[model samples]
Target: MTIYQKVQAVNHLFNQLDKDLGSFQQSTGLGCVANCGLCCLKPDINATALEFLPLAYHLLLNGETEQWLEQLQNNTEDKLCPVLNKVIAPGSKGFCSDYAHRGLICRLFGFSAMLHKNNTPTLVTCKPIKEQKPEAVAKANAHIASKDNYPLISNYYMQLRSIDESLGEELFPIRIAIEKAIYAVLAYYAYRELPSKDDIV
Candidate 1:
């Protein structure tokens, strides 16, 4: 399949996962703190190139791919995500500039699960949620144990790899992942005619 096709497929999975996470949040009343960007401030976040394909493709369509590629390449310090904005203070008020096309880690961090040694799923969440809504966190964990519909980190990652073995398998720092994703799209269209926005749909 073409790069564009793979991006769309991966995005479809993300959309489904988003819906599931929203439902889980509504049911259990557990969610990110209002206007909190603490998790976004973490510089160690990792992701795969395939996870950022949609973001790179969006930038390409908007004629911003080269600009972002340059910014990411120069950001060798590997600070916070390039897409993040208003980060005047670490773990303070900020948000992703391109919310719609954020990577898989961005989507799953606050509302997903991690597998334990005994093969049990544990709800992985942030400190604010754990401290402010301890009861909700416990309830959400119980709900996960009783239900099978919540999005799983391992499962979605497996789905990502199924889309493209090479791009999906290699984990990179989030910045490097974004850079690789942009280059992948650019290389795919280096010789071929660029697909129109309508063609993407």
Candidate 2:
């Protein structure tokens, strides 16, 4: 499949995950704090190249791919995601510059689950939710324990790997993943025609 095709597939999965996350949030009344960018501030976040294909494609269309690559390469700090808006304060008012084109890991972070040793799902959330909405967190965990169709991180990742084993299988730091994705898109179009917005759909 072509790079455009891969982006479409990854995006389809992301759309579904968004729906699931909405339902989970609605059901449990658990959510991130308003304007909270704590999660985005984390230095250890990891993602795959395939997940950032949409973002890469977006940058390509905007004629900003090379510019972004240069900026990413120049930034030595691996602590914060480069996609975040630099004008905003780091901890409280952070926001992704490309919110719509954010990767799968960005979409799944606050509202998904991971499997534990005994094969039960644990709601993977941050400290704010645990501290602020303790009861709701408990209810979400119980909902997962009941096995009633909450989103599972492993399942989504497995689906991602199936989309394109090579690009989807490995994890890199957020900026590295974004860089790899930009390169992948650029290389794919180097010897071929760049698709228009309508062509991609």
Candidate 3:
């Protein structure tokens, strides 16, 4: 399939995930924990090259691709994610400046579910939830007991890997992934410019 097709497939999966999350949220009433940027601060958040392409696409569309790439490269520090906006208040409600282009890691972590090797469902959440809503935790445990479902990071990567043997398989630290994502966007547009809707395929 073409790049646009691939992007569309990824987006479709996101839509399915959204429906699932909506149900999960309504059932549990356990929203994202407060002031939670722990995942953001995580030293190692993994993302695939395929997962990053859309982000690059977004940067290209915004006409910020080259400049953003240069800025990311110039910042020798490997720890900070280039797209991470610290000023946006360190909470779950805070969002990435470029939400549309967020990598798989960005899209999956907080809202998604995961499966255990033993085939159990596990929620992708942070410490605050475990602390603030013990009852929610209990309900989640009961939810798991139902063996309903969860977003398994590994499970998703399997499909991603199937798309491009090299792509969805590997994960990079969030910063490097963001850096590469930015570069990819710039490179795509620099070489051929944005495709008209009819030319997207």
TM-score for each prediction? Answer: 0.92, 0.93, 0.81
Whole-model Cα lDDT per candidate?
0.87, 0.87, 0.65
Q: Which portions of model 3 miss their true places by more than 4 Å?
A: 89-95, 111-117, 183-193, 196-201
Cα TM-score of candidate 2:
0.93
lDDT of the structure predicted as candidate 3: 0.65
When summed lDDT is taken over every stretch of 10 residues in candidate 2, the lowest stretch is 85-94
Record all residue pairs in model 3 with backbone atoms less than 3 Å apart, i.e. clashing.
113-150, 113-151, 114-150, 114-151, 114-152
List the pairs of residues colliding in candidate 1. Answer: none
The parts of candidate 2 lying over 4 Å away from their true place are 86-94, 199-201
lDDT of 1 by residue, 5-57 (tens): 89889999999898989988988888888778888888888999999999888
Please identify which of the two predictions, 2 or 3, would achieve the higher TM-score against the true structure.
2
Backbone clashes under 3 angstroms, per model: 0, 0, 5
Q: Could you give me the TM-score of model 3 versus the true structure? A: 0.81
